[model samples]
Target chain A: MIEVLNPTAGPATGKIMMAERTGTLDGLRLGVIWNGRPYGDRVINSVIDLLRQKYSFESVTFRKKPFIGNVAPASIRDEIVESCDAVITGIGD
Target chain B: MVDRLTADRISVENLDAAMELYFERGWTDGLPVVPPTEMKVMEFLDYAGLEPGRPLGDVPERDRVITAEHLAINAVMAGCKKEYMPVLVASVEAICHPDFRFNHMATLGSAWPMLIVNGPMGRDLGFNSGMYLLSSAGNRPSSTVARAISLLFWNCTESRPDGIQRGQFGNPGRGHYCIAENEETSWDPLHVMLGFDREQSTVTAVSTYPGPYQVYCQRTANPELMLDSMADAISTYDFYRGTYILLVPPHFAELFIQRGWSKHDVRRYLMDNCKRSVADLKRRGLWGLHSSEYDGFAGVAQAVQPGDEDRYAYVFKPHEYDRIMFDDTTLLRRSDIYVVVGGGNAGPRLCFLAPYGVSTDPMTVAVHPV
Candidate 1:
């Protein structure tokens, strides 16, 4: 049998494993963060529209990242957290 | 001690049965394996002078600690002889090198590790260095050793064939991509120039994407002109945007030797002279600025401003062209330029510039005598 270790440890482990729960989509403000790839924005926009039609969600906020293959800056992540109940991020070419 | 079933010596037939069992269990890479019998495994452990449970290294991404016994088991499955353990150990060390960045590399959508063996071990293991050396010529220990190591990666790591190790277009090298330096044919041995003594056996593993693009310049006799051609070849759209190069075979070294040029001299020239202008890159449809979040022609903005000459100058500074073409020259320092003498003595020097996003350090395993 193979013994597996925790991939991240110490401070990194705590941050990585912390999960936020999401409730129903109805009337919830949704945010989409796009990583400048064309398909990413399109995918996020499609999801938003579909969610809106299905759940009659209140509103949507959109943020576009400047670079591909990189994570959004902490400020942007904070902005996303403050502005929307739930956020979806995407990356691609 | 008359014949109990357990007392029987595990013969070749029993080994074959075990191989079949491994296949039935789906533990192999769809290839037949030489069953690693307990005796064979023990032999390998003893040959490597390793304790059964000695830790090879921790595979971080998998979070699994690999012991010497684990590797020995896989080596047996890969049909590796007891003597090949040294090479396997070295390869493991190279992969686990902090600079090698194993976690990111394995998960990338690239092919399996491209094993490039260097030093005296190449010759000792009967690695082909002349005439279609990289291609399969059969029964070469170097080829099998590389194949075995790759197979070990698949079996041991979380990166399996269908799961995390997702390679879209895998090359044949994935099976066994290894060769040695034709040091006897070249002016200076590859490892010696790279700070290792000529007597020291070393292996340099370069993570590469696919087979190299050939840059042949048979007609040019002048070394300067030939080098310019080589620089131009390396400056192609794909290469210019990428990082790392693997200098292969006859042509490159032969030209230098014929003209009394050193590896350092050639490197300096390539760094100084090889470049593509921003205008050229733009003209070739290589450079473009697009919305990072969007795709297609609509998202693509002109990479360079039409009238911004200063920005253009900024992008194409001296020595910067080579950097742009292949990341930074810091990457192209003496350490990164892995030279191996191979292929026929004649023809253009075959240089393979590695594609972008591939790791530059190769995984090297030493070959021990069986």
Candidate 2:
């Protein structure tokens, strides 16, 4: 009779994967993407107002996404990448 | 001094040596454990009918991979019988499912998975489905199984006391949280009512962060009125809109049975009736609405759009009490309401709400007797 050997007794073989980040947020142009909802629009407006009052900005632009839980549209994404220093997206209810 | 084993066959004399090896390898839950002798480990591997090196699953976020051999080692340490290996394996599988989000669960500052057992295996494993079931009053298999799984998680995964698993106000359930769905007394078995085959045994592992909240109601006969009370309970400040509910005891079911009300009926009633006006939620200061950089206060002020008849709908509306009240219940079908019967017979009481910080739909794991 052929004896079946269990192979699972070996030492554990796996590693933890971590998320990656690009660069720091310094004087980059900030692009804000808002879901075309009342809450998102409102939050964007508040943020813009604060930036205007507090810091000097190189350039700032705004784009609106169609749905709350969805990614920004291609047009909006392109606009953000081209125009803004760093992108800020909001999922306001 | 430890006795030497012949042909990898460890004797009882090597027990202390094995425990010391485990301690050196950082494989313990603080509590002392019985050493996994080579013979005992072989027994567990045989019981699971698995190869000693079969990969259980990876703890993705932690970067550590788990295998059957690791689980068997932890099981022996947890004082589990070799016959319980199948249940342990199944629980590990359920937790590792992508939907279960095991990585998020380990780091999140809440108690680990609360194992809920259903089906015939629950009774066969000596789990408590009746009175004082949630408490540790009875010497049932529920406690032992729950403890065994928790130990496995701790040992295999990189979860240590103050390391990664940080539960601020840990619950007693942390010690071991395994309870059965009282199928005999219940009008519906938990798994069957949750869209599983009534005959087949299934384990669901839900990752809830805040633990469960209890909702008790008595003295209301009208189904609508009773559901309304449930709505109020679910709409509290702590209650989020999308969390699930676990119904306990037969009293709630008795009400539905008496009124010819299906789970769907209760869900619809709660959804339609449990809601307060969007204005009410804001007035009560329950909205944790955050303002963005662009909007400023002006944007936030504008976000409160005018509702019908010039009313403003709050950004965060109270969750449809109906959805939170019944799982498996669809908004349209009302009958999709998920109801599991358990606990001792008493007044109509239900436990609803999911863990805080994590997503709704906690993973539920059932430990079976092999």
Task: Name the 10 consecutive residues with the lowest summed lDDT in model 2 chain B.
Answer: B326-335
Best by TM-score: 1
What's the i-RMS of each model? Answer: 11.5, 11.1
RMSD vs true structure, all candidates: 7.6, 8.5
Model 1 residue runs over 4 Å out of place are A1-93, B1-17, B104-111, B240-243, B288-336, B356-370
Give the Å error, residue B299, model 2. Answer: 17
lDDT of 1 at B68: 77
TM-score of chain A, model number 2 = 0.62
Query: For candidate 2, lDDT tens digit of each residue in B114-192?
Result: 5666776766666677776666755436665677677666655556664466666555565466676667642557676
- Model 2 whole-model lDDT (C-alpha atoms): 0.56
